[model samples]
Target: MQPGIIRLSGLFFLLIGSALVLSSFGRVDNAEKDFSPEQPCEWVFKISDKSLALFQDKLLDLAFETASSIPMNPHIKDRSRAQETVVLACLHLDCPKRALRYMDQIVDWRRGSCYADLAFYFARRDCIDDARRCIQIASQISESAEDWRRDRIRVKIAQTYVWLGQNQQVDEFEAGVVDSELGKVARVKAMRSDADAFHEQMQVLETRMESGNFDIMNNTLQAYTELFHRFYSDVQKRSLVEEKIKTAWNGMPISTRIERLTDLAEFALEHSDSDKALALVNDAQSLIDGRQWPLEHFIPMMGKLAALRFRTGDRQKARSEADAARVLFHAQKDTIVNIWKAGTLRPLAQAYQTMEDPDAALSLYKQALAAGIENPNSRPRAEDLTATCLSMALYAVEPDDDLWGQAHRIYQGLDHPW
Candidate 1:
């Protein structure tokens, strides 16, 4: 209300808290919706908090009631389920800050269980210190530390920081280089050393990939992709990376080899080096066929291959490969597949659209949107979901369904940090 108000943002919170609920509810014209898991929670996944504000008070009441009823539990699963109810409800109320308040009162869900969630919300609100605090708490806690999902979240968070650090390093280095004549001389020497440094980094990444930790390999590959671009600061440095990448792939495990090749193939495709991309894709195929990768991995690799074939005017083979990928994906249990289910469909749909098959493309887009809607943790791939959802929303202008609303929810998720 007043300038220079104290209370560590209490007044500010009150104003924001009140306005968002009013603004959100007022903007929407939906009838009173039922508040339950099957409908309400799924609604949270489909609609933005701004659109859910009409149920704000009801959601907070249910959230508090749910958390209070569970008090404590010996089983982490039960406690987790209870906390999830509160979190989901708070999300709908447009009060993630309030969500953390309830999360803190639980007093039994361990520590890190809520830290990651809190860090994400606080980061979105631009409360850097609070987000950093949650990250510290998350790292220090051991509860559910062994869960693969938690580890994946940690790796993702760590990568964000590393990315920012790398960008800062590059900016500083470039600024120093441009500051003086001596800096120009230093850049010449630094470029030579960077080539050697790039090779060394690739070796480390190769070793990590060979260690057989798929998650680690994924993260390392992400970093390698960024660092390779950065280290190759000159034409000479850029030319040096390709040979080292080739050497590193030599005799590596088939999975690692395929990963390297897939990366290079994608890079070449983006750079319009069609021959290089096709050659690498060919090399990756034999390895892919030899290994039994999950649908999550296999579908993307196959889809990329099909797209390359499509580009080369091999329409027959492209359609065949796309059909094979769809069949294999349909066979996968939902518990094992995630966003990749929808992700692979988008590109295939694009290819169909390019081939003058709008009906086929629309069907695939619908399939992709459904897959995204079904996946509970679809926010990790909010980008892809939003793209596919946009296509679906545009294609289906039916009054009975709300594809546009679904697309809006995904776009909101994209606005938040993963």
Candidate 2:
């Protein structure tokens, strides 16, 4: 062959070899040529389930390893399905950290489908800025979203605002979405209308208060109290709601008194607010005395006082008040009262445990469990109390033993879908 021709032949061969090598390594010169748009959603859904299960088991390290082995950018259909699975899996695992990381990828392909889930995860993690950004993006796509899914996303956004303490946002969202006939009718129908709408309204107001919307707090409380009164028709329960609303209104400027009082009482018993909680409890007691509130009507307040006393290092007073509440609970023979009684035991047990009375705490926990079981409607409370009691007892005795196994079994037996 001629010298120039031989050189050209050699260059062509080398180029061909390079092309062959690249093909074997899954590389392509043309991006669209390599893309497979026909990929199905099922393939992505399976991978998502596996990933979510691993995450739930706290096997993130393993999940990462598996994800690393998969192709980086699959076909859009496959990618969209995979993103849905991954988003749901992250939610199930309560791992918002992972969800946030993968969210961009999901949104780049499928926007509206994952917004509600992403919003919920972000809200739960208290990632306000990111959540708002996600909401804005989701809102744009929401017009094209499914009706049920859009409603769900709106609710999630409203809840996120609630957690962020954005009272105005909550009100705006609720008034625009939730307070509509559709919203009220849907939730009311969901709860079967047997229960008062006040609980749901209170939840909204509490969310607003939590978001720091104090301006509307009193009005919300009044509205809530009226709703409670209209539903209960029981003079005592109405009076109780009225009293609580009054206290909430009175304490408005002084630090969202209801929230502060509850927090102080809880803090006094749990962490660093012992003295402050005691003082507040004293004030509450004085107020109760001044009003001559009926014992049945004032049990919850007394329970708070006892908790505050226990936190303030007043063991005797705490125990006395707890015992009094317990007696009143039993005497009333009211299922609602029994539920409160069961709730009271939780604090009493904590107090006893704090005073180094493990035996007493354990006993009270057991009693609480029994009380909870007696009222079938109180199964959730019973289950929780039983779990705590078992866990605590196990820690107090032998951590290595399978004490939690029994509690886990009981928890599994319950009908709670979560």
Candidate 3:
């Protein structure tokens, strides 16, 4: 061979060797062993360092081993895909440093895939700065991405903002996507409604403060009470809302005590904090028992006591309390109280079932179903209880019966599958 050609061949071999070495290092650092019979050489990657840590703490090695069963293309030319895979592997290893390094590589790609994945990764890490950067890049990429991808990116961005305590930003982001290319009509509508209601309530409270209209203050408090009830499942957000309500309530006259207790009990119930609900109910009961309050106060306290008893697995006591509450509600002609009273019967039936009294359970279940049918909207939860009771009754009679089949059929008959 000519001298120049020989030199060129040597240079080419050197370059190829360097590339091969780099690629191999990348693979070894991210490589996961797969012992599954079905998918050898495949790597399963996680994307959250905290989640990986949790899995490790739980000693869920089997899950990690199973995830490693997926295969990768050893010679794939896409460096971005390789980086993504590495990021996932590092996450699975609970190595945030390595995961962030690969995430940077993907961010350099500046594509929709990179933006979406990196946004979620940063959000999971609670790195708000990186998450915001990812959101910006994602927004730019979203202009050219598919509609579904854009919608997903928008929701992720909103969620990230929510995590960062930028709730107003979440509102703005959701509003922009409401009727836009994103197809999240229902979520957008609900969020917008909540934001609007919260704002309106704030305004009403401000106005009442200026005008000294205590009657209007009642309306403002009620609005917030309802709003908190509607969104109480979210602990952090509910805490913030409750703080605001308490601050406002404390500034008002002592005459608002009963209403405040009522609202707090309702909030506790909505959040599934049965202990808190019971405590608030007891506070109300003290006023009634001391003759400082009326029979109406005792009514709500009795209902809450029944609910607390049922939650604590004391169904017999719960049933007695609920029966008394039912009579009081009927005498007062309070539909809301009646609804709560009817709610107790279903759980009472479950208590009977637990006590091995199927006959009593069946009778209570039938009564609950009849009450529910008469006031469908008021007892919206009764259908599920009815189905449960029917299924349990069938099982107690004959363990081999097709109770599940019947239950499935009943679920299908319902307009909404709740």
What is candidate 3's CA lDDT for residue 26? 27
Candidate 2 residue pairs that clash: 165-211
Given candidate 2, what's the lDDT at residue 140?
56
The total of clashing pairs for model 3 equals: 3
* Candidate 3, poorest ten consecutive residues by summed lDDT: 1-10
Choose the strongest candidate by TM-score.
1
C-alpha lDDT score of every prediction, in listed order: 0.46, 0.43, 0.44
Task: Find the number of clashing residue pairs for candidate 2.
Answer: 1
Candidate with best lDDT: 1
* Model 1 per-residue lDDT tens digits across residues 123-230: 444556665676666555423344443443353244223323344533332332211111121211222334456656656656655754544444444445444444
Off by over 4 Å in 2: 1-260, 263-276, 289-300, 313-316, 323-341, 354-356, 376-418
RMSD of 3: 22.1
Ordered list by TM-score, greatest first: 1, 2, 3
Give the lDDT of residue 91 in candidate 2.
49
- What lDDT tens digits, residue by residue, belong to model 2 across residues 229-295? 2444444644455455555565464323433344334433433546645775675565566554444
- The pairs that clash in candidate 3 are 42-70, 42-71, 43-70
Superposed model 3: Cα runs more than 4 Å off:
1-160, 166-168, 174-279, 283-304, 309-319, 326-366, 369-418
